[model samples]
Target: MKVIVFDTKPYDRKYLDKENERYGFEIKYIEGKLTPDTAKLAAGYDVVCAFVNDDIGAATIDVLVDVGVRAIAMRCAGYNNVDIRHAFGKIHVVRVPKYSPFAVAEHAIALLMTLNRRIHRAYLRTRDGNFNLNGLLGFDMHGKIVGVVGTGQIGRCFIDICRGFGMQVLAYDPYPNPNAGIEYVSIDELLSRSDVVSLHCPLTAETHHLIDAKRLSLMKPNAVIVNTSRGALIDSAALIEALKDGAIGGAALDVYEEEAQYFFEDHSNDVIKDDQLTRLLSFNNVLVTSHQAFFTHEALEKIAEVTFENIANLSAFRGNRETYLANEVCYQCEKFGGDCPKKNHKNCF
Candidate 1:
């Protein structure tokens, strides 16, 4: 099988090449993303494996389908970037639904600790021999109420880390898990009671900008916010306003709401157009990373391995047994229990 992997980061090539021989596919690593403009890159390929930043919408999918591309494999767990409904009958789309949840969850904890202890600022000060800790006082995480907005695998792992710190966990999810040490609460209650709020939910119509101005105002004056999930979950303008008004204490964002223009690129020479992000950077309380919550060594290895398998399995398919087929995600089996109960052939999952 000929596979073209777009959005070829250095780390992606490193891990993908580590187990390249096992899949035995003629792989081409492309530097650019899978946008409508770059869809022609996969002209002769059978499968295309993409990352989070790729534009795999209707137009891009049309190009891939017009060419020989059969399967679209997302290396990341989230499929929010792909237009599932539009691509279903035309082309196949597969995703790594669960990878190393600990990688992302632990990264969230790292951001919180870094923000709380002022370690980022302290490092800058020590390099210049300032050695000042005047305004760096931080409270312990023990007994602090942490509001976890989702109870998925990543969210559960995050709760595990917070519980280790002896923090009281409050969770709000459409599907609650009692096994995890999280007590399900209303979003309003969670916002009012928590010292830290972390968003782990996926981006949907109902969840998009879930943390807007009204919700932001419901939070405590000194509460910290952490988002390692989809960038669209929180309104960037609302967050900026909250930060400016001191309605919230601080924020650690792994993903930005408008990341497509800037992320995974080198723009150090140019001025960033997003003035809000620029202002956020000016403040010591805000910490931002380029959506690197899932960049752990172990997670990358698994992503590579699973992506290779997805390509191979997709190539080896005879007919309808294709795991990467758009119908498979909507094909609810007995194993799916009551979770995927949509038998209306809508592909709405």
Candidate 2:
């Protein structure tokens, strides 16, 4: 099958090319993100491979359909960028729902520990041969309470890591897992009682801006907040105000709401246009990374493997019109007064 991969990076090319050796599919890599302007690039391809930041909205979907693109293979778990409701009958969408959860979970802990212990500051100081220990006092994590906002694979992995540090774990999820081995509490209770609040939830109507002004106010003044999930899950403006007002002690973000415009690109010579992001960079207490928590080697391999498998599975049933080969976009089939083709409703991995 012929596939066009968008939003290509060096590591993406390396892993995908290595994995494609087995599938032997005709793959074309493009450095640009998928958008209306670039949608025509997939004209002759059988499938379009996209990443987390690519825009697969209505307009792009229309263009792809007109150009004979049969399927979409998302390399990431989140599909918030794609408007599945619009691409209902025209196309099929498949995604890697679970890559390496440990990659993101470990990165979240790394961010929290670095922020709390002032490792970044100490690295800069000791490099200049100045070894003063003032202002570097950090509390022990042994007796601390870490409130996990989601109990999914990534959240559960993070909980296990926190337990390794002897931290008390409290989790909050609408569909709580009884086997998570942590106390399940209300979001309000988790916010008020946690010494460290970590967000691992997805971005959706109910979860967007989950941590807003009121929720920020509910957190302990000395508590630390870390987010390795979707950026829009927290209100950036509210977070800025909280940081400036010292409402929360610190924040470590590997993602941002407005990251699509800037992240994964180098802008060292340009001025930052977003005032909220600019202000966020001025705070020493806040740590910001370029949405790379899921960029580990293992995660990249799994993403490529699952994405290829999704395409293979769909390609295998191209002649069978009765199969729900659209993957998770089957929900949109109801709009056309037709039953979804797939019998099982499980998420595609």
Candidate 3:
């Protein structure tokens, strides 16, 4: 199949090309995202491969369908950017759901350690020969309580990391795993008692802005916030207010709500237009990284492998079998109709 992979970085090409040697698909990688204006680039391709930041809305879906694109493969787990309501019964959508959960979980731990130890600041001071440790005071993590929201694969891995530090774990998930050996509490209780809060949930109507002003207020005054999940999981404007008033000690974010416009690209010559992000950057306690939590070699290889497999499976079956595509959604039945096929719940049409 001819695939046009959009929003591709150099690393994506390096790994995808290495993996494509096995599948032997004609892959055309584009540096820009999959927006309405850029959708024409995939006019003759069989599959449109997108990344986390791609704008695969209703308009883009229409263009893809009109241009003979059969499958929409997301290289990442999250599908918040896609318009599932409109794409139902039209173009098939598939994703890499569980690719290297440890990559993201370990990154959450890295962010917390860097923020607490003032490692970023220390690196700058030492480079300038100012060797100062006056403001680098950090508390011990041995007895700290960590609140982990969403106890999925990545969240479980994060809990293990926290437990390794001798920290108590408090988790919140609609579907709790009793064998995970963590105290499952309500969101309110977890926020109030934790020294650090990490989010690993998906972006849905209920979870959008899950960490808002009310939740931030319920947290400890000196608690830290680390988010490697969806960007809209926390309200950015409200978070800025919390940071300004010292309601929270610090924040280390791997994603931002408005990051689609700026995350994967370089804008060094241009003035930043987003005031909220600008203010967040000015804070000494805030650390922001590009959405690179899942950029590890193992994670990328898995993403490429699964994404291609999804494309190939959809192309081969072209029928009613949906188990091949992991967690495929029948948006037609899920959103509009009440009756979904029991056998192939993943892709009921």
- Listed per candidate, the RMSD to the true structure in angstroms reads 3.0, 2.9, 2.0
Encode model 2's per-residue lDDT on 1-349: one tens digit a residue. Answer: 9999999999999999998998999999999999999999999999999988999999999999999999889999998898877876678888898999999999999999999999999999999998998978788999899999999999999999999999999999998988666799999999999999999998877899999999999999999999999999999999999998999999999999999988999999999998888888899999999999998989999998888888888788677765545344554443333453433433221
- Displacement of the residue 145 alpha carbon in candidate 2, Å: 0.6
Cα lDDT of all candidates, in order? 0.85, 0.89, 0.89
lDDT winner between 1 and 3, please give it.
Answer: 3
Clashes of each: 0, 2, 0
**Alpha-carbon RMSD, candidate 3:** 2.0
Model 1 per-residue lDDT tens digits across residues 109-214: 9999999999998888899999888878787999999999999989989998999999999999988886665689999899999999999988876889999999
For model 2 the TM-score comes to 0.94
| Backbone collision tally, model 2 | 2
Of 1 and 2, which scores higher on lDDT?
2
lDDT of 1: 0.85
Instruction: Give the TM-scores of the predictions, in the order they appear.
Output: 0.93, 0.94, 0.95
Q: Local error of candidate 3 at 56, Å? A: 0.8
TM-score of 3: 0.95
- Decreasing TM-score order of the candidates: 3, 2, 1
**Which candidate would rank higher by TM-score, 2 or 3?**
3
